[model samples]
Target: MHFPTLATPFIFGATALAASLTQVSNYNNNAKAKPGMWVYKPDTVKSDALVIAIHSCQSSAQKYFANSKIPWHQGSDRKGYITVWPSSTTECWDVSSKASLSHDGGGDSNAIANMIKYAITTYKTDPKKVYVTGGSSGGDKDADELFGMMSNVLAATYPDLITAVSLYSGVPAGCFVSSSGASAAWNNTCSGGQSKASGEAWGNVVRNMYPGYTGSRPRMQFWHGSVDGTLSPNNYQETVKQWTNVFNVSTTPTSSKPDTPEKNYRTDDFGSNVEGIWAVGVGHSVPSHLDVSEAWFGL
Candidate 1:
C-alpha cells in the first residue's frame, strides 16, 4: 500500500502547521509498500531546541498525532520542539529486517532520519535534543526496530544525533517464554524450544547492536498497564531488567498510585532522572491526557 499524499484538504484546523505529509516511495524498489510522515512545524517559530520523531503502529502519522494530542505549534511557542509522526508500513512493525511488514526495507527509518535532517536544515533545530518515543505496537515492538535503525544511520548522517527513548506497553522485540508451560500459557505463539531459542538470539542481537549505549541510550521512560492483555506488564518489567543488566546501571523503581480514577504506577532513578509509569487500570491506549500534559511534562 502506498501512503497518501498531504493535500490541502488533508490539512485541516491545526494540521495546517504540518509542513508536509508525503509518501516515501523509494524504500525498496522491490517492496510493494509506501510509508510517510506527518511533518508538523510550529508556526511563527524561527528555531527549536528539540525535535521529537514519533513512530506509530497501524495508525497513520496524522491519526497518531491527532489522537495523542502532541501539539505541533507548541514546539515553536514553548521551548521550540518540532514533532514528526511517521507511519509504519503495516499495523505491526517488522523488527527483524529493520523495516515494516510492507517490505519497505528501511523506508520507515529512513523517513525519520530524512525528516530530522530536513528539520535541522530548515528549522534550525538543536541536534542534541533529538528524542524518540512510541506506544502500543509502536512502543512495544516497533520502538526497538526504530532504535536499531537509528543507531545504524544516525552515526553516519548526523554523527551528533543521539536520542533518548521512552516505550509504553511494549517489550523489546526478542522476549519470549522460557518453559513449555509458560509457552502454552502464552498460547504457544511465543513458546516451544524454537521460540525460546529464537527469542534469546534475537534479544542478544538487539543487545549487541544497541548495547547499553552510554550517552547514546537516551534516558528511557517505560510505561505499561498492569491489566494490559495485549502486552502484559511482565514484558515491560523484563525489558527494564534486561536493559539495566546490559547497561550495568543501578535504578530503584518507585511505585505509586496517583489520585485519579485510574491507578498509576511509576519508577525512576532518583539520581539519573529516568522515570516510568504503569497505569493500574489503563488498557492499550496512550497515557492519560492528565498524565502527559500535567504529570509527564510537569516532571
Candidate 2:
C-alpha cells in the first residue's frame, strides 16, 4: 500500500525538525513499559486536536519520528495539531497483559492514557479531538512478537480518552488474550487470523473493557495488506466484523472501491464511523495514509 505524498508537500527544514520534538518526563508512574514521551507542537495553532502515534517493535519514538512514512510531524504542523509519540523502554508494548486490556488497569495502556491527559492539559488540546494511530508490533498481530497489540488494547481500555483510532494491521482488542484473563506473548491463533468469533462476541470483548460506560464509542479505521504474511489479512476482516457489530451497522459495506487509482488498494466504508482499507501486495505495516487520516480526523 503506497501512501501517496500529500498535495501539500513537506516543507519542514532542519531547524523546524530540531525544534519540534520535546521530551516529556512525567506521564505515568505505574506503566510496565516505562515509555519515554515525546511531543510535537505545530508552529501555527490552527486546530486543537491531539494525535498519539505509537511505534512498532524494535523501534524507538525518536526513530519513528525520523523515519515513519506517516508524516506525523508534518501533519501536526500542517493541520495545526499536537502529536505525541511514546517509546516503549521494553522490547514491545505491554499489550499482551491482563492489566493492559482492562480499563484503569495499570500497564502500558494506562500509561498512554496518562500521556493523553498530560498532553491535553499541558497543551490545552481539545479533549474531544484526541486520536491515535500506529503500525506493526505497536499496531498489528504478529505470531512471534504480537505486533498489532497497542492500538487494539489502548482503544479498548480507554475509549473515552480517544475520539478515534486508525490501526495498521491490528487485530481485535482481546485477540491476544485467553479466556482466563491471561495474555499471550505470541498468540499464533490470532496472528494466523484464526481467532474468529461472532461480531457480537468480539463487540462484547470491547464493551467488557469498560463494563458500564454509556458514553459514545470512539470511531475506528483499519488498514491491512492482503499479502502480509506477518499479520494475515484475515485479522482485518475480523476487525471490520467486530466494529460493524459494535455500531449496529450491516456487515456489508455501504461503499467499496479503490482508494487510489491502484487496482488492489480497495476501501470499504461500512458506515459513517467505520472504514477499512485493503492493500493487495502490501506487507507488514500498511502504507501510511495520513491524507485520509487527516480528513477522517477532521484536521
Candidate 3:
C-alpha cells in the first residue's frame, strides 16, 4: 500500500525572503536510478549549507515539496542554505538490494549522494554542513516492503557525506535484510521490534556500510509517534538502539524534557549527538516538525 503524503498544509504566509525553485533530471550520470529533482535556492546565501529532503514511496519530489508544510525552504530563505528534493524512480528506494546496501553501490542512495555532490559543486554549498530529513517510508525502508525510503539509511551508507539526520517513523538501516544474505521483502522479526542487539553489534552494521572509515559519524535525531501502527512503535525502539550503538552513547538519556512544542511530546537527549522524540497519542503519520527540526539542524 502506498503511504499518505502525511503533511500539514502550508500555513505560513510569504516571507520577506524567497527561494527560487528549479527542476532537474540529469544530476547524476552513473546512478542506477535517474530520479527527478526539485532544487530550492535562497536568494541570499547565508549559511552556505545544503539540505536534501526525500519523498515517500509513490510520491514525487514536487508532491513532497508542495504538499508538506515544512518550512525548510523558508528556513533556506532566511538561513541561505540550498534545499533539494529527489523522487524515487521505482516508487520506493531499493533498500532490499545488495548493491544499495553497500556504500558507493549504484541505487537510489547513490542518486541522492550524487544530488548532494551536484548541489555542493554547482551551488558551492558546504559539504560538512549537509543535513537530511524525511518521513515514514521517506524516513526508512523495511525488509517486509511495508515502506521504503532511505533517508536514515542514506546517512549510514555514506556517513562522510551527511552531517546530521532527523528521521520520522523510520526503521533501522539493514533491518530488512534476512539472515540468508538475501533481501526479503518481509521480515516479521524486525518490524515487530523483536530484533534486539547491543549498541556495539548494531554499530557494526553501520560501520560495515563503509568499511575502514574512522571519520566523524553523522549525529542523528529520531522521531516517531507513540501509537504509530504501520511501522510499529517497536521500530522506534529498535532505531534508538541502532543509532545509540552507532553513536556509542548510553541507551539511557542524559536529559529529558516535556512541553517540547507541546505537552505530552517528550524529547529524550541521549547525549550530545543522539536524540529521540516521542509524540504521545500520534500515529504512523507524524507530520514533519519544521521549526523544531530546523533548530536541531542549527538553521
lDDT, candidate 2, 80-175, per-residue tens: 888999887776676677787888887778888889999999889999999998744323343223335688787788988999988777788888
Candidate 3, residues 1-299: lDDT per residue as tens digits? 23333322222234433456788767764766577777988777777788988766666777666654555666777677789987766656666666666788776677788888888888898888899987443223222122223766687888989988887777788776645544325567766667777667777878887788888988888787787666678777777788888877788989989867677788999998988898888776566777878877877
Best by lDDT: 2
lDDT of 3 at 24: 74
Residue by residue across 14-116, what tens digits does model 1's lDDT show? 6645543343333223333344545565544554444444544445676655554444334434543456556665653333333321112343344455555
Superposed on all Cα atoms, model 3 deviates from the true structure by an RMSD in Å of 8.2
In angstroms, how far off is 98's CA in candidate 1?
A: 5.1
Ranking, TM-score, top scorer first = 2, 3, 1
Error of 3 at 192 (Å): 3.0
Superior by lDDT: candidate 2 or candidate 3: 2
The TM-score between candidate 3 and the true structure equals 0.85
User: Model 2, 65: alpha-carbon shift in Å?
Assistant: 0.7
Ranking by lDDT: 2, 3, 1
As a whole number from 0 to 100, the lDDT of residue 92 in candidate 2 is: 68
